[model samples]
Target: MTDTTAFDWRSFLLNWSGEWADSLPGGETRSEGDEDARRARWLGFPPASEERIAAAEERLGRRMPPSYREFLKVSDGWRHAGGFVWLLAGTEDAHWHDNESGLADMFEEHLDEDAGPEERQEADIWRRGLQLDVESDITHVLMDPEDVDENGEWAVYTWASWRAAPPERHADFLAFMRDMYREFHSLRAHRRDGEPEFANDTTRKLDAQVAQARSAALRGDWERAGKELDEAKGYGRPRAAGLGDQIRRLLGQTYMVYFEGLVTDPRYAPELLPPLVAEHAAHSYRDDSTLTFHLRGAGEDLVSLAYATLERVRAGTYRYTAAGPFGTAVERARELARWGGTDEAWRTLIDALPLWEPLGPDHLAPLGWVADPVLGPLLTPERGRELLSTPRGGRTGEAPRPTAGLDPGGLAWLAEPDPGDNPTSYRFVLVEGAAPEELPERLADGNGGGDGDGTVLNERLTLWEARRRLLHGRREFSSYDDRALVAVGRAGSGWSFAFDGDPAAFDRRRFVSPAASASAGSDTRAVVVWSGLRARHGEPFFHLSVARGGAEQYAFTYADEEVRSRGRIPQALDPSRFFGDGEDGAEAERSLLEAVAGEFGVRLPRHAIVNGRLHTFTTRSWTRPPGDGETYAVIHLRGEADRPADDDRTADDDRTADDGQGSR
Candidate 1:
């Protein structure tokens, strides 16, 4: 039971699929056509019973290599395209194929009779057969079981009726298959989509530039912003679905309105400065008496000098009463300009005063509710209240309220299997910028982690650590697809295909579920289903797949390897159980939500339920206080919804109404 470093050949060839062929040029992949037949043919024939393989060996005198023998039981022969391999040969056919008798002498004699020194040399090296199939394809690449490698496995060499150059070698049949499929997919994809250099360093540079441009635009600098975007425009996306292209697209599409007209107005208007600041910008400077507000405003000098002026005012005694110098406290702060501040400086000071109770009336006036037209609309009523009532804004020991959105940690989702499943491998879906080592052998059930080259060998994340990592958007996956997760209990399992028994019986317990009918209103959101593998029938295949639809529907799916649609994954979570879709459901649902809130420090927002699943339109957050008694720095789970929808809006409306605070 020692760990095997070799690529697991028997499992791969057994599970070898032609599904990758669809990734070739024709966009409409595996449609209702010859594609299925082609896939079956390319995958090779079904298993050759043990008796059949034994007959072939008995007739051959010599026993077959263990790898080759094992392969025979999986499939007697590749249906049509096992890289030009044919059926196994008995002794007589082997003798002829190997040229074991007088074939070489005969060829040499024929060359002598037709007599030429060069031709005679060409005939000198007679080819001896290894595991020769009964029939050869147009070209033949033979697995030489007799010739072993450093690990005592066989070597592979190509042979044919005609010779052009020396044959290429592979370490073993499994290694040979790996090379074959690598080329096969490359050729297929090229045939389908035209060759392009994808996922390279050049694309990375463009991504970096696009991200920079996005940052500049967010800070209200259009000129500096457009320059970076313009430089990155030359590189068109490598592939449409890849993360780089998606990132570039998002950068160009979002936040344009914020920068559209701001460049012309260099002056920081009170209406504009307040909205430009980030949520993390506020810092309790020195002590609670003075707070630092960082701004990503119009100009460096304008912003810096404005910041200094505010620091001076903060240094001195400042008061904003109902009756100050002018009609309001904000206008009174404007009076600072007469003493040395610019108009922009005055605006900066006023913009930040909404929450500065030390300088304003004794009321928690969050700026998101500012009366100014420009500031009011952008600062949604829901967000404004969040600034005041959310746990992130609350004092120590006070819980943070949940905001609804996507999982900001990452779009990828993973599931913890039932203890009874005894699952050994875990899968993560829709992750970006991840390498093999980060996920390690954890990603697959078999010995070789994906390609079977067996180089992947690091195990980094503990189950909860993995959950915390993905909840925060870290890259545990290599792709940008954020909609799947799978874990397997046995070796060589994947998505359930042509499986047996009742599918619903295999769902994992204790996972997050969607609500049935939300009290908020008529709610239509996404649902997730976890599919357990029926491991014994074929290859090991366990999957948690998303029933794709809107952004809300596809919040997260727990998956480990490449995903496949194997019919509908059974719904494990009933929204009714958690959302009171029917009567007698709310008390338990609310209790569970409350418990989860207590642990995560977030109140679960409005949500619906389906079956056994819990789906809340709320962001979960946990604050990690600094070690050694430090409290200023804390970590929280941030939400990043895929898109804004009615589910989010409905939830917000319900919260605002229930709390009896109209935007705080």
Candidate 2:
């Protein structure tokens, strides 16, 4: 709420002069000489005497609101009350809205049938309100005597004929005047020459507040600084708003594209203006609304230079000179940009932003430097997205390194010929305090003890042999075979590891079922990590699940670029920190794997997964038609017999079988 009692009307309306119209409706006509005379008076008429106010109120058969009466005492009338209002009525000229505009019948006709009581009442009040403005751009400013508050202030409303909406209601006349004052400042700020520097008492007081706020911001007292700046902005201080935006950017609250202050100081303009101009230019190209660059006189030369540099950046010929403490990081980013790795280059700079030192007392951060000649063109749409999505806080330290768990990239060979081809599409499960040999039995237990039939065979074999068997089955039996080869081994940290080659094994009811049930015992836990390299054909996916004492403690899945989670995932394992826009699928998977490995401190030996022997088994379950009802069966096979017949083997199967020979 505005402090209407303390508002200095003269100080608030200081220097209020602009071009005036030739004439006003129901008011005196103004010639060029009369307009010049009014401009000299600062658009304020002499204060109305108490006798004049009394006569006007007696004619209207009502007393005026306290705020409006107070305003008339300060000035009989005002010109250019806001951007739209042209002339405000003096006490003698004021009249009832119902007797003049005749808008009640039209409003009643257009009112919706489902209009609420408040809306209907508002329309009714407007019909009898006192009209204040004599001329406007299809705008009406009214005060309702029937809606007086405890302070004897009437509610004020402003409606525009072209808006096709209800009139906006203000708490009182003071509030309406405050809004108009703010509008005046807002419009003034956008002028090509920018807002004029005001030396009035109000501006001096607001400037002191802004200085105090800046000191508070420097001291890291953001809350206090924000409150002070907000108060100053409410008073329509342009400098306060600009500094407030700077603080928001520092706190990662907003990514401000345009700044308010003129950057004419030679000390800061060279370092700041390029990025401002580039960002403004980039935004102008992408959006229909173009922003004005508030550069005037000597500052105009800097803008011209910035535009020329931007042209070179777009042509891929711009070079950035590394400087200051972050020179090495800037050089690295420059190199990355040269190769068309725009996202990576931008990320590199973003990572180094926290370490930037101010060139002088006025500098904020490296945020504006993102449009440095070398880096400006790298601000592609995807790079801009990455910038916006980057986490709020500055980087804590270098990314965590994997000490225990398998690098997800290391396992890519299981699905593709090389780790670089695509992210390996496989599921890796870790169960604590469980032996490798017990995995198959636990899985069989979860599968209802294998159909209660003797034909459900289980035999131990090497990991390589199991891989051959799975491949042979898929090629010779069914390309979409439901069979899964579960290779059990010992992972670091006393946790048992199970590697399932099937892409769909991440399903809770499939391979994860046994681990979930097995870890149900006292003091046991299970963790599963999966990556689906669907980016080769479509969108990529990643999933993580943690279970303890038979209950799922955490479950997270990132599919189709959206995240879904149940329970709390550890902060260290958050996938968002590792993911980036336009990131390669394999690189993204690798980064996620590293985070999980660092969090859990567990690792799987690469040799064991690809070549070494381990207790491996093939598990499959399906339903068959029965004469009476449905018959279900489970097949748990192991050893060389699990391999498909030689006559039915494909060329890939022959290769896999040959690879398994020495390991078995």
Candidate topping lDDT? 2
Model 1 clashes, total count: 51
Q: Which stretches of candidate 2 lie over 4 Å from their true place?
A: 1-42, 99-125, 161-169, 181-209, 227-239, 249-257, 261-356, 359-362, 365-664
- Tens-digit lDDT track of model 1 for 358-384: 111111222322322112212333333
Candidate 1's C-alpha runs over 4 A off are: 1-11, 20-42, 79-96, 100-126, 131-137, 150-152, 160-163, 192-664
Worst 10 residues of 2 by lDDT: 622-631
Clashing pairs in 2: 404-602, 404-603, 405-602, 405-603, 520-550
Query: Model 1 residue 9 lDDT?
Result: 44
The global C-alpha lDDT for each of the candidates, from Candidate 1 onward, is: 0.33, 0.58
TM-score of each: 0.24, 0.46
User: Candidate 1, after superposition: displacement of residue 610 in Å?
Assistant: 80
Error of 2 at 537 (Å): 25
